[model samples]
Target: MTKLYASLALGLLAAACGGGGGSAPIATENASAPAPVAAAPAAAPPADSTIDCPMFPASAIFNTRIDDTARFPVHADNAAWQELVGRATPFTANWGTSSNPSDLQDYWGMPFNVVDAAATQWPLVSFDYAASGLVFEASYPAQSDCASSADGSGVVRGCTQVPASQRRFPFPSGTTLAEGGDCGGPSGCGDRHVLVVDKAACRLWEAFYAHRIAGQWYAVATASWDLRSNAMRPDGWGAADAAGLPITPLLAKANEAASGEIRHALRVTFRDAALSLQHVWPARFAAGSDNPGAIPFGSLLRLRADFAIPDAWSPQAKAVARAAQRYGLYVADNGADLHVQGAPDSAWDPAVWQQLRSITMADMEFVDTGAITRDARFAKDSLQAGW
Candidate 1:
């Protein structure tokens, strides 16, 4: 399958970012950038969609424990990136605990759906950016879900390009796109990320700028993966998430917190003005600022080991704080500085999560991931994050 390649200048991609609570900033700096070349994540294990199912195998990067500061010391660039991100930028928990999407205060957290692998699938799509080079030619799920039209045309947008990828995802019928409620119910505008998982098959399908137009689904960019494997997306390929990373695995889930531990890293974003042109290993692309001395994708920021979890905090908050001290958070995308991503669930208590906002960038340090033997070895094209 020879895939049609998109240009580095994907002008039509996410003009608006659902993740950022605003318009998606185009990477004008990457217009002249070359595409990435890398290995796809491969190998796998038996899978299931059950609640107790693990997000990924133990060896997967998300599950790798990085709190051993003795072995994984702070990166040399840690101080610089921290200073650049600003010490005063407070940590903002960007998810809702309420189940009612309409009850969201801000543009609520990103949403995901789980379904059986055998569910009906559709390849209905069309790329908006000049990202033909990034298209993987895989099929995606589209169950004829429709966003009510503003124009009342009663015409469904047929596929000029059929785009759901090789793996299938299906949001339960009527699942709202991320920020869907805040933007304008289902017809709203925002990053509109749609993440669907096949629990039984251990597969995930994600799309950016997703919408159901005229009784059909559509997106500018999309990516899919087999959760049970460690191989990455083919080097240089674009994914729905800005960093070319999976969105859900890194999310701060209430259920995980209830279990008393978050084994994997959490997802975070900083302002694009401070993003680096370069991305690290595990991050297939750079989706932030072109500014020099800017932060880069795949950067790790750990809560200082000495930072104490206040006794007054909720158990969920304590669990997240402990995870930050241990597994830490990854600079997964370009968004507001210090904003941590999570799923919207009623289980998330607003009171406790609010307390997490006090831990600012001043309390964190970056991990020099190149120090790790397993992480450093997964190089893509000529790009490598390890020292």
Candidate 2:
């Protein structure tokens, strides 16, 4: 009966939350209010600096120590927390599951990876104000693009009042559909995620189940982030990804690759029913599963701090290993078991990439993150006044 209830909840949750498999045709006309005038492009970063990379504010949730914040709602050293990690099944690269990819590269693939800056090479189709113009709709907590509407299948179908600074996502001017949505297979129809970085503004916009019709952008869910703050997504809300987490901050950035170490945790995935209802802080969902031993979303899995990086490893791989030992990896979504995320970069060595598979779940320990506590007021405060 427990398994049966979880199964039903899973099905209902998917429909309510805009699961990756479905799609609706783009609408030429918007069903919501119009967007505001475009804000001036954000001030460009200094010549020597990159806007989004290079510097992550100390306050950013990714960079913040779990023990440092007054907002940490969980009691990290609780016995329950320790027991959770000790008993929960651990998955690594070679887990013999049908959905688990054999290689680390295949797991994240296009969901993230650096795209070439060249305009013509951008694969996702692009539209401008002069052409099929884009639309911005303000999403509400109850009437969210990713949540169920009063009707059904809570997908955002129309446009509302969104700002150009927020919605006029500076997708690479020549960005084309990389691979997703209509471009992917029926069962595996990718989320058709659209990510736009306003370098000048130092902001990021990401969407899931995205589509462009008559030049207008549409999405089932969207999220925006300020590159400067360590703010978190509201509890119980969904972001472009199912984890209700930000994707860019979690990614292995090009700058980090160049610096030879990732300072933050890598975003990872678990198959459905392998997640729990109690998300650790920094994560917004306690994505439910039938497995009693499933790790809660936002749980931190760290490689032993003193673990040695093999001498044969490349500098880039070592940096990643160092990060695992330091900041650790955070469970962000439901997908394959233990797949770490990094943006695509041609510079990656195939051998270096493969070495990541060597660092399995066994080499890691679940950090003591205290105990889980729910505060409705805190959850509301984390939300944007308007999306």
The C-alpha TM-scores of every prediction are 0.74, 0.61
The sequence of per-residue lDDT tens digits that candidate 2 reaches over residues 140-197 is 2221222122111222322233222233333444433332313432134454556654
Worst 10 residues of 2 by lDDT: 146-155
The numbered model that scores best in TM-score is 1
User: How many residue pairs clash (N, CA or C atoms closer than 3 angstroms) in each of the candidate models, in the order given?
Assistant: 33, 19
For each candidate, what is the lDDT?
0.61, 0.47
TM-score of 2: 0.61
Error of model 2, residue 128, in angstroms: 20
For candidate 1, give the lDDT of residue 356.
Answer: 91
Best by lDDT: 1
| lDDT digits (tens) for residues 1-387 of candidate 1 | 001112223412432221256433322211354433233243222222243345655656666678889878988888888888888888888787666666657437886777554553443454332234332233221211111122111112112222323222254455554645446523345567787775655666677666555455556556665565454664444466667778878888777776667777799987777777567767766654367767777788889998888998887888888888888888877778898888787777677567898898989998877665355455453322222
